[model samples]
Target: MNTTPISSRLHIAIFGRRNAGKSSLINALTNQEVALVSDVAGTTTDPVSKAMEILPIGPVVIIDTAGLDDTGELGELRVKKTYEVLNRTDLAILVIDGTIGLSEFEENVLKIIRDKNIPVIGVINKKDLSQYSEEDKRKWEEKLKLELIEVSALKKHGIETLKMMLIKKAPYDDRELSIVGDLIKPGDFVVLVIPIDKAAPKGRLILPQQQTIRDILDNDAMAIVTKEHELKETLQNLGKKPSLVITDSQAFLKVSADTPKDIPLTSFSILFARYKGDLEELVRGVKAIKKLKPGDKVLIAEGCTHHRQSDDIGKVKIPRWIRQIVGGDIQFDWSSGITFPDNLEEYSLIVHCGACMLNRREMMYRISYAKSKNIPIVNYGVLIAYVQGLMPRAIEMFPLAKMIYEEE
Candidate 1:
């Protein structure tokens, strides 16, 4: 249960107007005081998430966000943050204030949710306080053209029915898009080339590495972990030819050199490029590198925030490499963590992190947004492989991606 990463879990976000029983719905759903309850207009200023197992639905992350109707300068900021939650939200629960009925705000929120193609559950909260009857409920259902579950969160009424609805609407097939599982067979050995550098976390493997190893095991494949330097030795020591070799983007040069061409080779970032985003599109973005001029802007986006290391891959290494390849004072911009810049049209290209910390929805949103803006976007792995002149060999395992690279 604890093994599931939050990023991988089903993200169910509750959104509504201030004092709309959003917090109350969260608490009742979890059967605990997971979210703060108050008479105040805005108790949850930021998105707060709790990970737990809802049977039949399995492991999930429930997010409670600030009300969309929050006002004032600070409240507007809070509301903006709440909207950002939609980027990562897998499923949404739009809580309607039973007394107030559906307002323009709720209708607009519904529009945005529909626009994203996210499956949602409409919940009419504070049901006990409302004088509305069955006919009114039918009216809401007719108005929205979707089922609405009425729940008196304060009274803990209809919570079970809501949970069942969540189970029915939940997306359980995302795990089918494995990190490294699909490439290897049950008994095949897969080698991982991880480099423990200054940027490496002190005590444990990073999220991408950990998730990859777990995916291999889950698929009943053997995962052989080794440092980038020991990749040659590890491959030699294997009794049989391993199915695939996955390395960190930083070590693509050395690892690609060590791994035989006969064996399929790729990187964690590349895997995530496919797992979390569009692989073929990203592969196409690599060609944009050749067109970059000195004065052109490149946006480096990271999904997680951390202390910058002397040779941090996102901050230092990527920028330095881009300068070396593209040359001559390219205006490099950086954005890290939750908020992705809306002004993508300002950049010629976007170099994104592996995005292991982010869920698929958010990463896809960024990729699609960049595409919509007519800006080329590529991830750490694909860009590194491209720059190193080893992209063909690195992506040979995936025919479609390789074809895209070849065509570009």
Candidate 2:
């Protein structure tokens, strides 16, 4: 459980005003000094995240954010950062000070949570102070239209009840989708084409490849892994057609050429696009590539930060391919991890990575964010397919996405 990726865990963010005991509540919840508790008003300047296995909730990433009502110039920046955490937050814990009662700042935060449509649990801390009563809880619950839980971080009272409420209210989606198992039956053979390049992690396959193999095994299917050069021979020696051929998007051209036309072909990034993002919407966004004009601004965003190889895909290959397709130069901007620009209107298109390191909710938030600004957004795999004139084949495994691409 400790080895679980932060992206795969449930993200529970704590939001409140200064000295609302947010840090103390986090410490009590995890039974550890996960957050620094201080008497100072703005000790938590940025979002501090900790990944742990909470009972009844399994694995979760608990985030402690800055106070919502921070004042002054620097405080405004801290407050801005707090709101940014909301984009990736799956569930929110809005902590209120029992002594001060609820304020407009807390209400404003609640409104944003409601607008985001994520589940939230209202917590009234400092119960040991006796400043708040049951009537106060009832009135606030009625006014906010949310369930309220009382807890004393200092005395640890009602902590168990808060945990129970968290278990009951935390979003639980039982329908866990598979990477490739749903598309293939038991005993079916699937071939994976991975390229061992400078960017490849030493002595190991990337996370997506490892996860896809695990999923195949879990479904009672067989997964044959090989490099791009060995893919042709591996397929020839199998003596049986594979149900699907999934390859790295960077090696799409070589893998597609080696595999038979009848066999369904896709990429790891494409699978993640469907699993973590909106495939149909991304496919629709690919059409915008053909409409690119000279001097247009394009933003390429990656979900993880890593040292760039000489021929990095995002920095080198993608730009070169787009220029060749457009027959002219275009301005390109880059961003990685959780630092997406707020002024998205400046770009004509936004190309994002597979987002295997990001949760489904965060990926959807990014896609929805781009859409709200009327900017077209495409994923790495879909963009590679479009540039290589294989968009239809790359998404063939996803029938609905393929149909949508064909129609466009």
For candidate 2, write residues 1-408 as lDDT tens digits.
886778788999999999999999988888889898999999999999988777778999999999988999999999998998898988999998998997777888899998999899999998888577788889989988887888899778888898887788789767577888789999899999999988999999888988899999999999999999999999999989999999999899999899989999999999999888999999988889889999999999999998999999999999998888889998999999976789899999999999988888889999999999999999999999888878788887778998988883
Clashes found in each candidate (C-alpha, N, C closer than 3 A): 0, 0
Model 1: colliding residue pairs: none
TM-scores vs. true structure, each candidate: 0.97, 0.97
Q: What is the lDDT of candidate 2?
A: 0.90
